[model samples]
Target: MKNLIAATYAPMHPDGSLNLGMIPSYTTFLQSNSIEGAFVNGSTGDFVSLSTLERKNLIAAWAKDKPKDFFLTNHVGHTNLNEAKELAAHSQGLVDAICVLPPFYFKPKTLESLLFYCAEVAKSAPDTPFYYYHIPVLTGADFNMLDFMKLAVEQVPNFTGIKYSQYNPTDFGKCLHFDQGSKNILFGVDEQLVDSLPLGATGWVGSTYNHLAPLYYKIISSYRNGDIEQAKLLQQKGVFFVQTLDKINGFNGAGKSFMRLFGLDMGPSRYPHKTMTDKQLALALKLMEPQEIAPLFNTSFSVKHLQAIG
Candidate 1:
């Protein structure tokens, strides 16, 4: 959880089967861009649709050539506690960390119950650093993270921190500074990631990091150098990237397909998530070119595309 962790996609063939072959190229692509790690089977990776074996295969493939300094986290969250524990157990000697979002189906009603669920899964893989994926917007377990961590300290032995995907800056800042900076809260919102800099966030786990790590790193440097305007503009480009792709079909599928522009063919997305057409992708690149967010990518496209495309 140190550098930008790309919330990776489950590569697929056009027929909607798992395309495990794309991972090596993907790993090289991320390393080339300084992305540092892969956050597999999370929301971006479409964990819910994957079978237990599929998830395990993904972890194994990505873990094969993982660099010593690279960070690799597998999202082991599932609707079934048993399945979650199974995945956590599966990830035991593989990933650097194992993360779990609250079970969205049955859903935990209270923070304590959610912590109870987390503790159960964490204990399965006692050696792995466990992170609670605090994405309340998706999971409906919208309890306070600071409160969660406080209880976690007393409950879960392997509890590490959170993959906070909410937008509450105050709560986020509080979590980052909690226990005299002992909490390991990785910022999740891409548009407001720069705000986390002053709060001392060195780690982030987000899907957009898959596409915009360079731009984000530049934004961080710009913010540090007092170029607030430049930083704000870059952050806005990130927002623009989301808004644009989201408009085409939906951001998840469209963005997944857009990875082709970077040489990683993630192929088609799974059910309920529309994969982009060639015509659609062409239009997307055309629309994106006007934004001038070139530095956001490793591609030859210039980072100076848009100043106010918003």
Candidate 2:
């Protein structure tokens, strides 16, 4: 499997609509700066708010612009299996893999239900590599890593790996060590890549990677190459940036605003998710400027470039 430093989504317009035009430039920026891949229509993409067609459009647009070697994982998860399956089918030839979070809203009455859901999804995306996305905090379903192992090995034949998003390093480590043969465990916390790497995390999927791709690539590359000190320093800087956003009520508004500052006309976030004020924007710029981090505002690269690098 190709290990990668991947972002979660392309930014959206202020009206909360998909900003298709920004994708090519954004993918180019990722390629020029060493970002290895991206995961679209995931939580960071606000999948919950978008319609199925919109999600398909986003995936199609990305597939068109993304470098062939730049692995793209489409998050086709939905509360309804039919909808999720439809999206998965639509994205079949468009992406490298398909990641689906466990059914949300409805708590599974038994392990069988969860396993059944996985089986269905696996059946739907027969040709696509299917990864189980476990983010218990958001879904209210606490899926133990052991249970997931059983589900993948015995029940879900097409299941290839997981995007473990819970914040517990030990759990992530256990999952990574569980079945290293065919199962891949991608660390989902942006701020914990350095700590997670040593524990056997080969890939990562996170929201902050959208704006911090260059830095993330540097850290992951350093760790993979045995440059521990460099990785640690980069991780420290990442943690600092993450903390800064946390202070401003997390990355919701701050991430979008930072995208705007970088020149993607990604409009403000939708209502219920407030957009940053002038003071907040000032604070964000001040916090990021010293780090010398330039957002990929208008760069363009093709999937061919990514394939060549690979």
Q: Among these predicted structures, which one has the highest lDDT?
A: 1
* Residues forming the 10-long window of minimal summed lDDT in candidate 2: 296-305
lDDT of 2 at 86: 90
lDDT of each: 0.85, 0.74
Instruction: Write one digit per residue (lDDT tens) for candidate 1, span 68-121.
Output: 878899999999999999999999999899999989988999987898899999
Candidate 1 local lDDT, residue 269: 89
Candidate 1 worst ten-residue window by lDDT: 301-310
Off by over 4 Å in 1: 300-310
Report the lDDT of model 2 for residue 184.
80
Per-prediction TM-score, please?
A: 0.94, 0.85
lDDT for predicted candidate 1 compared with the true structure = 0.85
Q: Model 1 misses residue 161 by how many Å?
A: 1.1
Displacement of the residue 119 alpha carbon in candidate 1, Å: 0.4
